[model samples]
Target: MSLAELLALVNDLSQSDKLSLFKLLAAQIPDAELQVIFSASEYPVWSPYDATEAANILMQMIEDDKEASTRA
Candidate 1:
């Protein structure tokens, strides 16, 4: 299923059901990996762009950062 469809299903879940689902998924990852994922820099709230547009925006940001790092 596409991410949008998966997100739609998740949005329809009850609070307890969401927690259960989160636990189920989280259990599959090792503690160390989860810690690294959680510790990564938090992304800003998404702007009102479609998924494709948002992905392009992020790609540009990544490339800009790469260019800046190369200059430094």
Candidate 2:
């Protein structure tokens, strides 16, 4: 599905469903460490388990989306 289509669908999912989906994505890929890109002073701890783990999860999600779309 297109990004616009995906966004529309994602917007309709329940909070619990979203959380469950996130946990499932995390289980598939090990958590990735992320460093703050703006400053060099201090790097904040980042993980797929963190609140924004959606960043990492989205990356995997996009790849999966591509494959699924291709198959369709």
Candidate 3:
């Protein structure tokens, strides 16, 4: 489902239900899987795990962009 629809559904829920729903959602999203997603995306995706190795890659990209912008 889309974010707008999801938000609407969340808002329709009671506070207790909302927390439970959030916990359920959170449980489905594993950190290892999230790390993989962050690493593979073209855009910068932050990760807590060293497994993704995105920090070095993203930082280098950011550095390159900054240098390019300064040169321009």
Candidate 4:
């Protein structure tokens, strides 16, 4: 659907439903960017553990955003 249609539907939703939709959308976007602290001749390091940790952090950020939005 178009953005206009989406906004129209969102306008019809109750506050709780709108909040839920906001959470879903927020979870799909990351709130931060990882900076690569690399030295000359060295590449940014990444491991399975780092990937898992990043995912957890992103989820936590999304939850935090949701909570903050609810308070507004």
Ranking by TM-score: 1, 4, 3, 2
Compute the lDDT of residue 52 as modeled in candidate 2.
Answer: 70
lDDT of 4 by residue, 1-72 (tens): 999999999999999999999889867765452132232366678676758878998999999999999999
What TM-score quantifies how close candidate 2 is to the native fold?
A: 0.38
Clashes of 1: 0
Comparing 1 and 2 by lDDT, which wins? 1
TM-score of 1: 0.47
Task: Please list all clashing residue pairs in model 4, or write none if there are none.
Answer: none
Q: Clashing residue pairs in candidate 3, if any?
A: none
Which run of 10 residues does model 4 get worst, by summed lDDT? 31-40
TM-score on alpha carbons, each prediction? 0.47, 0.38, 0.40, 0.42
> What would you estimate as the lDDT of candidate 3?
0.88
Candidate 4 lDDT (Cα, 0 to 1): 0.82
Distance from true location, Cα of 39 in model 1, Å: 5.8
lDDT-superior candidate, 2 or 3: 3
Give the lDDT ranking, best first: 1, 3, 4, 2
Off by over 4 Å in 3: 33-72
When summed lDDT is taken over every stretch of 10 residues in candidate 1, the lowest stretch is 46-55
User: What's the lDDT of the predicted structure labeled candidate 2?
Assistant: 0.77
Q: Lowest-lDDT window of 10 residues in candidate 2?
A: 30-39
